[model samples]
Target chain A: MQKGGELVERTETRLNPGYGRWTPFWFLAPAVFALLVIGIYPTISALVTSFRRYNITRPRDGFPFIGFENYINVLSDQTFWQSLGLTARFYVTVLPFQLFFGICIALLLHRPGLGMLRALARISLVVPLATTYAVVGLIGRLIFNRDFGVANQFLNAIGIGGMDWLGSPTGAFIAIAVMDIWQWTPFCALIFLAGLSMVPVEIEEAARLETSSKTALLRYVQLPYLLPGLTAMLILRSADILKLFDMVFVMTRGGPGAATDLVSIYIQRVGFRVFDMGMASAQAILLLIMTIVLSRLYIRLIYKEIE
Target chain B: MSTTLRRVLHGAGLIAVLCFTLFPFYWMVSSSFKDQSDLLASPPVWFFTPTFANYADIFADEKVFGSIVNSLIVATLTTALSVLLGAPAAYALARFEFRGKSDLWFWFISNRMISPIVLALPVYLLAVQLKMLDTYLVLVLIYLTFNLPIVVWICTDQFRSIPIELEQAARLDGADQFTIFRKIYVPLGLPGIAVSAIFSFIFSWNELLYALVLTRRSVQTAPVMATSFMSGYELPWGKIMATGTVIVLPVTIFALLVSRHMVRGLTMGATK
Candidate 1:
């Protein structure tokens, strides 16, 4: 029986020898075709549309080829630069708050034997993470509504006067950032928690024998182990931040003098509100280039550290 | 620090984190049950008889009900289609040694890096030209860009993790390639497939930008309808809160069900 089984196995394996060369190709074809139509084709079309004056509102004009005009126009446009600047500021400001809180929460919940507290924290954290961005925006609007909003109401209860959150430029910008931080800090925390859990117990125990201070142990041992997770969090957050749109759209709508106009919102406005497809495509291409380049740089840095 | 002091500090930090993470959801649910007068009350009425009027108002509207259905259909169909197409490709990449395999792998992973804005205009124009705007099919097709990469990434990792001995044993039993994939790989890869499905569902459900621009009147999803409440006159704080509650409830419940898998799901393909 064993010999017969071995003979059958060998023959069966030989029946599909050499990785079944044609099978994988057939298996991969549907996905490749889907990506081509949905991803690659549209991207190339966007590139083509950027060089033409294709305004949806102007059906009579037709999509005449306008070489470099849209790109040059976007380069000189003040709103474009302002939006880019705001995107950078939003990313820089919110990231540190999220990371700090994330690390703190991760450390607190990373204890090995604390079953109940860790479970509670994990459940609570998923609330903000799972809440849709649009809902977050709506909640922000409610909390920041100047007249009866809870934020101002809380301040007034403490004898501080109510401040206009959405009506003012800086308040609106800060409110948007706060909303982002609230929604995403949990994500960072959870990722950090996962990273922290991977730190071997023996390594920590050895460090504890040598060091008396918790901070020293963390700084020397745990942080180095968490470097990869930190890099992953940074890359993921930075990419998403660059493309942020929903909160700004729902809460501020780039209002009170374009205070919270992130690049995504600006591009959407250029395309849909202004019906300037050419300019929007140009701006989008630039945004895409920036996103890809920055992500590549981050990946390179992380890869070096990994080695 | 003394152990007592350390314990106190840790408890305090945990409480603060919990409150920060959960307060918004509390406020949303509470406000959803508040009357319009109670909703806008200064000093924010903490004690009040909760009302279902807001929920009643939103459910009474046909547009809102239609949007809820639209969101369900789009998210469901997108999840199914992405897994169907993406899992096979992931299996191929995981098991086969082909020319340019590494390059293909890199391309599949890097596809996640592309911003939706770059695809928005071209897709919108294409939809317009093809007369496919305001249709469920278009949203499902476009959502593939986001969902497929994740499916491929996670499913590939999943297939790779399964031992090759199982497949060899199946082959020894005289099973062919298709039978091995169906009877062996699919059943074994269920956990990973479930994770990928949850991811695709959450993404398609939470997606706003594509839905916002792609559909207008006939096919608006819940998120798009939720945004509509913000734009019009007399910002109906009651109905808006109610809508927010309804939109968040399903996803929150789903997340809690799979809370244990949250970290593993998010970090699956990225960590290694």
Candidate 2:
């Protein structure tokens, strides 16, 4: 056994240092190849496609390279700007509430003496995270159904009349945002819970000794320690929310007068619904640029905090 | 605040959180079993004889079952392929030193930051050109854009946690590098691998955008099928709820099974 093992090792190393040197490349090649095909190739294709008019409906037009025409058309489109504004609004509205409630619930669940309650909280938290976005949108539609929906029922029970959710512009937007908060707040909470767990007990104790006030303890000690976690949550959530498509698609289809037409929805509509691949590619490139830029800003801010 | 008052408030808060997190799910499951009339009953029917007619209705639809099969095939294949391709690269990054290693690692992880919309159009066009649209192979491949980064990131962390001393000791004992990796590191890093597998599975399973945009009638996944119930007038709430429950049930069960490792997987390279 020993001799056989030695032979294997000798053959692998002494006989083949060049093979040893290239092993990592071999391991990495499959993944790099896959990414090149799926990730990089598509990105490059998107860049090129953006410059050409390749309408599926008008294939005979011959996908000619139109230079900046697609970009100009996309930029000049009012709906594109509207969708951009809605996307921004959706992000701004949903993120703070997710963070606020997420942190609150995290703090609540993180409290030291709540054994069973904490377990229950943790289990329930995973349910939302486990749910698919499209399903969440379906559930949102059910609850917000104006005629006999549970939401309207609750409102009516409280003497506030039922309001049109998917039928009106503002209500549709708010409905989508609310649905997002419901689906994702638990994710934020769990992330914060993980972060809270990492906060050293000694630091908390030291802060408690310095101040008897809970708010001060939170403001001074817990929040600072949890900043990294908060930053991670923000980055993950913002990136996701910016590209959120499935929920809005299932719920409203960017309807009720395009009130909920997020940038992703707009792009899909242009590409698939309207068969405007060139314009959609141009818009998609812009969305990609926006995501990268925003994420970079976030990384810069967080790294500055860390330093 | 007094201790008793604080305790009461905490109790109330926990209950509220539970309801907030769980009510919609409960509603979905319950509505699945409710008759069409009970589904839309005013003030919501708190008590009723639960019926499985909606479940039967969805199951009877051949298209729904086909989509479910499609989802299982695509998600399972994507998960398996991602882990297979990703684990080695992760091991290499964790164990080997080479030029441009950090840059390469950053590039791999940053792939997660790319928006799916950016890939969607080009991929669709490519699929059209290649005549691979509505095929499981295309989806399994496209899903790599999301799943590969996750597998690499998590498994890299997992492989790193295994002490170098263990591998060196195995090497001194005349074990080849591949043998050491296969016999020692893999077993030792099984927990991380499990985390990566569970995450990749759940993500590919939950993914809707690619499945929706890429596939039409023959290859539609369960999520896409569920969305179809929305378009027609007089929506079938019962069937929709039933289908929603079907999509969520397996994932929720799997998530609970691996809930312990979830935070670690999700907060990869962030907190640590």
Candidate 3:
């Protein structure tokens, strides 16, 4: 008892509202330091590099500050506009399919009962999410192979003869879309499931009593709950789709004569392959602006506030 | 609709989703284990005597095997660094009312919106200037920056959910701030940390664009090895599949283990 009292006395003296004003800064300093060095610094450097003629091959001609020349070149180039349009098309193509199927599957999984099956289904969803993007491209290549692909085998079973999946412009575009949809649709479903879970049991039961039609009930009751998550998904997806590379790079490499050349791949070609650093940086900076602006638009228009 | 009919439809829907998600995985693993002829068979041989030759071939190749090691080192270190740096900042954000708090939060979260291509060239040049290209340190540092936002975002959510009374009690017991964080918040907040770690690991492991541009022969990652196959005239399906399976297996297992918290993690803790 004497020892405990002594310890309490020492503790009381020590507990003098110990935390100071700079405590949070001390905690945050390391991360903030690292971000400043690696994240913000590089971004500023990229912004600077975008305005100059910084081609690696032409070092004799020093990187002079040629304001807007690189931007003008990127903006005026027909190939850049085509690639940009294709990127937009890719986003438009995949979003609807993913959202539609995602919600449908989430609704199915959201149903009460089927305990074991529901658990198993959720586990299976992680496979696609976990698959490396490059591997997803390779998987696309193997599956879409004309001669020996499982895709053709299945199509043959269904009595549709195989066309060149990665050869023709239309086919390659579709193949990339299919791969993206396969990879991301599960993400949509998972997010929607989280949203659906928020629909209170009492509310769901009452709604079920009011209408036997699942569609009617979902339209009236659940979709409002889903809107926030749906908006989140849209913003994230828009950002991702705009910057997509790895998988398409592995699968097609902007292939069969620039058929599947999304903007990122094109920028990479200009930057690394063509060694035009300034032009590539300009294109990249523009792409970055587009992504930020698009997400901001989503937040302002669809997602007013998220708590 | 009858109860039985509704049940059957639900089962059908479940089957469709499973097939769409898992069929490619089955194909990849099955093809990886098949002999060359069976792998290239037209009616894509459903049944075959599995062989370890493809796996053996990949393991025997020095470059292929080396990249697997490189991926492991980079990803593991990146995960460790992200959690170590990000957790404390997250605790601060969760607990303290400080100046520029909202602005700081937005700044960190907005990092995710920056397209990698925007920074790719500049990062490549920075590495060149620093003479750090083709090294694991560069990759780890860059990945840490990318993964930090994820860790901070999730852990902040996790830390916020913990009761403030716990911290008050700890303080009453004379525990210091660091002690409260390390002892109380860290343990209670572990689920969030693990989820973020798993995500960080998977992302770094799977990352390609930065890995491709930054690392050359010496520190090339597993994804780079997988993509190098595309340059060859003859596509080796069996070996390619084996390499992919090896690369993806660990992270897939990690992801499945934490499926419960995945929704919260993926959505940056916006839901659940």
- Sorted by DockQ (best first), the order is 1, 3, 2
TM-score, each model?
A: 0.94, 0.94, 0.95
On residues B151-262, what C-alpha lDDT tens digit does candidate 1 reach at each position? 9888888899998768777765788777877887789998888888888888789889999999999899999999998766678888888988888899888888777677
What TM value does the first chain of each candidate achieve?
0.90, 0.89, 0.91
lDDT tens digits, residue span B119-159, model 2? 98999988988999999999999999888888998888889
Query: Interface RMSD of every candidate?
Result: 2.2, 2.4, 2.0
Off by over 4 Å in 2: A1-19, A297-307
Write one digit per residue (lDDT tens) for candidate 3, span A1-307.
6687566555644774346778899999999999999988988899999999999999999999999999999889999999989988998999999999899889989997677887788789888988999999999999999888888888889998888899988999999999999999999999999889898989999999999898998999898899888878888888888779999999888988988999999999999999999999999889878877865565455424531
What TM-score does structure 1 among the candidates reach?
0.94
Docking class of 3: medium
Q: Which ten residues in a row have the lowest lDDT in candidate 1 chain A?
A: A298-307
| DockQ of each candidate relative to the true complex | 0.66, 0.62, 0.66
Q: Which candidate model has the greater DockQ, 1 or 2?
A: 1
Model 3, CA-based lDDT: 0.88
Q: Is the docking of candidate 2 incorrect, acceptable, medium or high quality?
A: medium
- Residue B181 error for model 2, in Å? 1.9
Fnat, one value per model: 0.74, 0.75, 0.76
For candidate 2, write residues A126-197 as lDDT tens digits. 898889889999999989888867888888889988899999999898899889999889878877787777
lDDT of 3 by residue, B175-261 (tens): 988999999999999988988998899889999999999999999999999889776577788899999999989989998988877
Q: Where does the lowest 10-residue lDDT sum fall in candidate 3 chain A?
A: A298-307
